[model samples]
Target: MDRVKGKTAIVTGGATGLGFAIARRLEQEGAKVIITDVDVTRGKEAAGEIGGLFKQQDVASENQWISLIEQVRGEFGKLDILVNNAGISGPVQNADPESTSTDDWERIHKVNGLGVFLGCKHAIDLMRQSGGGSIINMSSIAALVATPFITAYGSSKAGVAQFTRSVALYCAQSGSKIRCNSVHPGQIRTEMHDSLLDETAELMGASRDDVENDFKSRIPMGYFGEPVEIANMVLFLASDEARYITGGKFIVDGGMELGG
Candidate 1:
């Protein structure tokens, strides 16, 4: 149960869905977790529920990232794990490449792409001071496949995957024990997923159930994934059990990326 005992972790967007599950899992396994989110109320509630701490943060802000890392350093004396899980899918109307506005594209990339980059960058600095640690960036199946409907999100996530590899190799070359990897989840049953379904249904003029069923049919597993499933993977990566693993892209996508 103490897989990450005495470790210190920071999970972004931990107020809900996948982030909350990941934070809870890490804390349950004995890590001292700090949950961060733009949603201050829910963030505090979530932290309270998990017996962790809460910090309000807008991940896209470099200043916030700097402050967060410093706070972690001050409170915990060291940071061991970081889950860059905060992101946005963008408005469904302008998500397509052809219709997406420059501002829309930049907004998605700001949070999904730049946020992870900053997290890895600052976390590396802190982690190096205290030996080394693990950095888990949450990507998505959209990153690995064609996502014409969510061009910005897919592109940003793709950037995350490639960047993770670069961070891992860079750390390894620099003789830093820090490990970096990306986790790509497919059709997880989260609020984000629900929003996607609702939007898709509206776009297609179909019932939500119909849209959901259609999506389910494409997944080889024939169902959406659970948050705990992804959390378990993060736990393993966060633990010393995966000490040898670095620069890897772990896909937890119920075989949906294998093609329908």
Candidate 2:
């Protein structure tokens, strides 16, 4: 808990799933966390549970980010960590690569890729003024491997990986104290996965349980990862424990891409 003592953090999409888990872990580590999510109800609940503040903000919206960062700066004085965890696999219609349209590509790029860019853009300035901070971007194993159906998602996450490195070097070149890193998780058990499993099951005319196991079979771990595992990694990166680490890509996959 002393690792992040006296620190303040902003976690986007922190209402549930991996984001919420990360928020909880940061709070446990003695950081005052502000959870931003589009779902006001869950966001408030999560913040209350974590003893943090809740703000409704869609990460894909640049104007919303401006207001959000301003509010965090005013209330918290300085931001120590920023987690760009909010994202989608793309709209339902465009989830399939063959069916993906230009508009779909653009939308996913805006949320999954551009959102990280904007977060780093605004947070780096604040972190610089405050001396330094850590930025953790939520990528996916798909970014490093083939994703036939989720082509847009895979592409967006690939952009995230490169953008993370670019921003990390930019900070280093500018002598800013901010550190940038990326994390990739494989098939975590979240609502997002549940929905995907349901969709795949329907398409395959199979039970959700059967489809879930089929998905798990591909993982060397023989099970889907829990959100808290990913959260734990984020906590480590966001805390002083990772002071010497920067510009790194940490994979939390359960050996899902072992040979790849």
Candidate 3:
């Protein structure tokens, strides 16, 4: 309760799944949250539910990023936290390096890679004006491991992880109090995960249950993770309790990354 009281936060892709959960958590902890997503209707509904604000945004657009930060500055007078959670995995098939087309690769990178970069870039400027803040970029286990099936998404997330470190170092070296870190979630039970399951099932000509079981078997924990679990980590990072933590990679992956 009140972990981030009086703070102002912007959560990208907050209309659903992990994003929505993160926004709700921040709002619940007393932050003034703004939920941004391309899905205007859902985004508004989500914001209303959480007693926060909503902004329609295509994160890939630099103009929109600029406008969003300006809006935050005008309304809140300062921005304290940013969760760069918006990203796209694209179609499961044709995602491999050999099968992926240039268009498909670029599309995934545009949203997953460039979006986070832009968010961090603009958020830093606003945060620096207001005595600095925390930036949490959502990476994934795919970034840590080889994801031959999702080459573009995996590569984009890997870029996010590395870029987060760079952002943290730059802010620190420049004497900015801003902190940057990446959160990598593994097999979270979200709509995106369900969709991936369905697609993988089809691609492998296997039953959904079999595909799901196969995925579960890969995890040492033997189950999917919940959204709130990831949200809690973000909350911790957003709070002053983690003031000394920067340029870190927090893996909330249920030990899946350890690889049984």
Candidate 4:
């Protein structure tokens, strides 16, 4: 539990769901936590709950990322962890790969792909100057499998996976202690997944129950996972327990990959 004690961390989209859980876990483990999100009201409340700081941020913007890194370094005196958890599932109606528009692609990549790029691009500088740190990027199982439904989502996540590896190699070659890794989660029951189920049901003209069952059937465990499961994996990566880990694709999917 004290694995991350005295560390400083930032969790994007930490106003709720998995991000909030990750933030809470780190803070509980003795880290200085800062939760960032565009949702001002909920983000502030969530940060207050854990006695952490809240910053309004749109992750896709380079300027905001610069400001965030500066602010965190200014207030905390150093940087240690950066969890690029802010992302979007793309437009629900555009779930069909064939019908997905360029607009939807832009929407998904801007946040899910470019946002992470910016996070790492900026965070690495700060981390390098302050003795290096951990960077955890939230990818998804969709990137590992054949996902025709959420094309944009899967593509963006795939970029994240590769980007993570590239960053890790750069740091190692440059003689820095900074570690970059991607976390691939499958069907975690967060607000994002819940909304995805609803959207799929509406698109298919089926009940939510039917859609949920179909989705769960693919999992070898025959069940969806909890947000905390993903959070725990992130925590492990953020801690010294995973010091030897870098550029690794950590999948916390309840054996779903096995089913495939």
TM-score for each candidate, following the candidate numbering: 0.99, 0.96, 0.99, 0.98
Please give the RMSD of candidate 1 to the true structure.
0.8
Task: List candidate 2 stretches off by more than 4 Å.
Answer: 91-94
- Model 3 stretches astray by more than 4 angstroms: none
lDDT of 2 at 145: 87
Q: Which portions of model 1 show Cα errors greater than 4 Å?
A: none
Ranking by TM-score: 3, 1, 4, 2
> Candidate 1, after superposition: displacement of residue 140 in Å?
0.5
Candidate 4 residue lDDT tens string, 1-260: 68899999999999998899999989988889999999999999999999999999999999999999999888887888999999999767856778999988898999999999999999988888879889999999988987668889999999999999999999989977999999999999989899999999999999999999999999988899988888889989999888889999999887888877
Between prediction 3 and prediction 4, the one with superior TM-score is 3
| Residues 69-166, model 3: lDDT tens digits | 99999999999999999999889998888999999999999999999999998899889998989999999999998967889999999999999999
**Model 1 over residues 192-260: C-alpha lDDT tens digits?**
999999999999999999999999998998899999999999999999999999999999988988993
Error of 3 at 23 (Å): 0.3
> Tell me, what's the RMSD of every candidate?
0.8, 1.3, 0.7, 1.0
In model 4, the Cα lDDT at residue 40 comes to: 100
After aligning candidate 1 to the native by TM-score, how far in Å is the CA of 6 from where it should be? 0.4
Q: Cα lDDT of all candidates, in order?
A: 0.94, 0.89, 0.95, 0.92
